[model samples]
Target chain A: MKKESQFTPFVEKTHFWGSIFSVLAIIVLVSVPVSIMFYLNVRPEISDVLKGFWGVALIFWPTALIEICFYTPMMGAGATYLSFVSGNIANLKLPCALNAKNIVKPKKGTDEEEVVNTIAVATSAIVCTVVIAAGVLLLSPILPKITAEGSVFGPAFNQVIPALFGALLGGYLVQYWKLSILPIAAATLIVILAPTIGTGALIPICVILSIVGALLMYNNGLLTGGVKPENPLKGLVKKDK
Target chain B: MDFKESKFMYLIAFIVIAFVIGQSLFFLIRAYNHGKKIGLSAKKMKDAITASALFTIAPAVSILATVVVLASSLGTVLPWIRLTVVGNLQYEVTAAQNAMEAFAGSGKAVAFGQDITDPTVFSAVAWVMTLGVILSLVLCPLLLKKIQKKVGKVKLDSGSDNKFGDIITAATFIGLISAFVGTSLAGKASTIEENGVKQATGMGAGVMSLAVLLTSIILVVILQTLCKKFKWDKFEPFVMPISMFAGMGMAMLVYAVLPESISMLEWRPAV
Candidate 1:
């Protein structure tokens, strides 16, 4: 009989809790508005709720599905449960986890990487929740300064997303130069030429394109050696171990 | 029971927030224990926690801005609760507007805040926003394990183990980055009238955003180059936020030089 890896039971335990907590999350989230309506003795008309939901769901539902399918593999098990529940995957949790994984240099498809990702994402969720709670508590005083028009911080705040993506892309370009070309070109053309595709749609299309592009490149013998040969910049940075 | 900010509403917000925090702590502790049991060093684990916590601060502040903008219409409690959970500014704002438009039965614009005095409209907005994102939450609990298992199978079947997995992960990341970069770079030029002055707006605004993007990239590259040369491994975690702030600072500087017709700042409409 083959002895099982020690990490197998840990991974199983994580999934068990992941499922339970995710269900708990769904229940708590759904119950909020339901409980509110009951307490207030007011119920929104089904027609109104459906119509409103349709307007947003028409775009978001597909995007949400794509996001889950796309992000789950990258985020791993425990991180996936916490991230999906906490939200802000792209702008917050994903980046945090990716950076942590990069710093740790854990082997991909390994238990160590999964543990690193979960820790990073969980920390991000905790920090984000605490910060938002504090902000809400101090909303009366801090809101005006943060939201003030023409404040010097205004431009800085507006540029956060662009800056974030830029820094992340810089690291990616250095690490994945060979695999980067087709997706970048495709995405650029879509944005420039199509102009009709929504931002939500653009992400999944580009993701699919990139996956196909990389697979083709890999099969063609253009890519090899598990991120070592491609990342010239990695040579410049000395790893401690 | 006012539709706007109320004490009872704050109570609801607190309850939801408690759940959010509890869930986060539960996951954090579980991951920490698993990491320790599996031979990950305590130093590395602590570093990940510190780095992730520090990285979250700036983005959390940006999210705070969304909560403030939504608060003007949806009340402090609702926006606070929504943004804290599985909601973002783009979705919440659009859902609320759509709900109001549906209630009005006209395609014409419907303002929120004081105008949303009706309890029915408020409930409708709440329901729509909640339901719009429910699919992701529902699918996650049901499908995540299957999805991850499939990915694991693909890695095993491919015979490359880490190579194929690395390529896929890198490709996914590059694909996402390309979309955002291309959007920021490819914004169309448009003329807009502001304060009785007609001026170029859209493309110029895009240019300013591009400048910020470039600045961040350059800063990261420079810092990374230095980190490489000097082997400042300890400074590695700070690179993301430092580059981000550098880019944001450059944005303000660039905005100062541009004409007032081009508002570098994003302005939410007042209720």
Candidate 2:
């Protein structure tokens, strides 16, 4: 008999906790409206609720389902549950976890990687919750500044995601240059040509492209037996020059 | 019945937000304990926590901007609740918009940005927004274990030459990042009507985005190189956060300095 991996029990326990939190979160979230219906005595028409829901559901439901499949493996079980419930997986949690993994250089499927991912995700969630809570408590003063036309924070806020990704790509692109080029080029071309297929949809397509490219390269022995490169920009300037 | 920011809604928001924080802390403590049991270093875990917390500040503020946008029409407490938990700006706004339109029902078609005056309309919007994201909550418990199992099978290499699992994970991440880059670079700037206001979008917006992208890339590369050369390991965790803020600062500069005809980095209304 194959001995159980030491991490199996841990993973199982994580799944149990993840499921419990997710279900409880759903109940907690749903109770708001349920309570509203009773306490306020403001019952929206069942048809109206369905009518409002269907269109948004048509878009979000499919995307949410797809997001789970894509993000689950990348984020470990604990992180996956928290992120799905708390949201902001793409822009914040996943990248934060990935960055920590990259910095720590954790091996795939290792306990260390799982711990790092969960810690990164949990910390991010805590910070975001606190910050937004502060924003709400101070909304009266901050609202006008943020919402004002031509406010300094306006342009900066708009570009936050792209900016964060830009920084992230600088390191990843260098580290995985061999595997990155084709996907980046193909994704860029598709985005340019089609333009309407938003980034959310493009992720899975690009993942396939990168995976195929990496496999082809690996089979051809292009990716193996090579040491990861040092920083290519290290020689750009001398401190004493 | 001003339910949008009513005392009851605020109380509900407080509970939900508190629950979210509690959930996060629960995971944080569990992961920390697990890390220790598995012989992971305390310093490493602490660094991850610190870096993640620092990294969250700017993006969290950006989310606050979304809250402000929705608050204009939907009310503060609702937007606050939605954004803090399982709701994003684009989806929530669209869901609210759809609900409002359904409520109006050919009378005059109320849009998302306009103040939602009807209590029933507001209630419907809240329900729609909440339900839109509930699918993941339901599906994750059912499917996550299976999905993780499938992925684990690939990753659990038994002394084989094939390391495809790790490569596949890296490829997925690279592909996702590449798509983001592509989106930032693609698109044409064109005029569009928003709330009866004709505004240019796409092209100039893309340019500004590109500028911020470049700023971030250059700053991060420089920071990394400097860290490596000087052995400033202590500053390494702060690298991403610094680059993020610097990139955002570049956005403001680009907006301020560029000629109006070319700089389409205008203040976009969230709705």
Candidate 3:
């Protein structure tokens, strides 16, 4: 039997509330369209809804599943739940969590790390929400100027992903130059060849590649300061006093 | 009934947005209180909050650009709700487009940016967008514990001597960032016609994107170095936001200085 004390009280509470909020958010999200139909007196055919849904689900569902698996380990329970619910994990939440974690240098898997990630994710969610709300009200006047021909905003907005990622990558490269080489080289080559694979799909593949590269480097004595020492503890585990 | 930008739609959007805000606050307070109990310094907590909020503003504005693009066809409220909640611009736009086409009923291809006159079409897009991502939300509550436990095991097995945990974490993030860096550097350009407007997408926006990216990298590197040198611990949080806006400003400057052939291509609505 598994021990009941494996998880701390804080983690247990986080799970309970996270599950509840996740379920509630889904119910509320679904209710919006249903409410719209009720108010407008128009019923969309079930077949149509399924058709549209299956098409997107074919793509998004698998990608989202991959994201959850990849990201959950880094994000603690609370951040995982809130981030999935609030969305924009890759572009916004993940970066925010990473920045906080790096700056604070919390030990992995500790309550402090969990709290830091949760706080970062939650704060990002709130700010994004408020900003969007404000933007909606204020965007009407500037909409044309933004979308108009030769609009600087259009080009600038288009470059956001690159600009954002570049800064992030700059920091990481400086810190983890060895780990950075393989993944950057491989991903750059792959994307140049097939730009259509999409970032979501590429994330998992690149992550696996990076792990393999790190393992290879560590095995080859490349990571051990040029000394490939033998396994010092080989066969020594059975010495029970 | 007027479905697009109706008072009713705005009200619905407001309610949903309010719920989202509440959820964020709920987690924020819980995490904040937990930090206190866990011996996190007050400065660390404040930095987390302040930095995250500051970092969010630029990206949120970019998201606002997505909302504006979608609003002309879907209406302000729907896009507003979609972007604010569990949907991204790419997924929402694609899902809504797929739904619109599926609901066409006449076998006619329905492109985005066409005014959604029929409430049925609007409802279909909404349903598809909502339900397509339902699994993500469902899976989190169901599988998060298992995933966390598995990852925790990896951490434990790594022990004190092995740097496996650190290596894996750094590698994972490096891999993710590298992919984006590759894409940005390659500048894959493509054109799509939406609502008879030809939009040049991808880094194909010319050297402009690449320039912005490099500028951001340089700015962040400089800022981080300066912060470390000057012991500007108080100003550390501003590094990302400063680089982001500077990168954006770089884009505008690049566009203005360079000609259309070398900079971003001039695209316009189709006649």
Listed in order, each prediction's TM-score against the native is: 0.87, 0.90, 0.93
Q: Score each candidate by Cα lDDT.
A: 0.76, 0.79, 0.80
- Which TM-score value belongs to model 1? 0.87
- Residue B37 displacement (Å), model 2: 1.4
Interface RMSD, Å, model 1: 3.6
The digit string of per-residue lDDT tens for model 3 on B1-271 reads: 5568789899888888888889989988988898898889989899889888888888888788778777767888888898888988567767777787685556544667778787778877888888988888899889998888877765654555446557767888888888777767663654445765665443452477678888988888888889899999988877777787788888888878887777764222112
- Estimate, for each residue in A1-241, the C-alpha lDDT of model 1 and write its tens digit: 9865333676777888888887887887888788668766797789878988898899899989888888888888888888888888887888889878877777777778889999999899889988888887876567658655467777787677778888887777666878778887888788677654656788888888998888777766678753333332233244322
Q: List the candidate numbers ranked by DockQ, top first.
A: 3, 1, 2
A1-241: candidate 2 lDDT, tens digit per residue: 9877534677889999999999999998898778767666788888888988998889889888889999998988999999998888888888899878866666668777888999999999989988988988877576658745478777788788778888888767656778889988998789667755756688889989998888777766677775443222233233225
Clashing pairs in 1: none
- lDDT, candidate 1, equals 0.76
lDDT (Cα, tens digit) per residue for candidate 3, span A67-88: 9899898788999899988888
In terms of DockQ, which candidate is strongest?
3
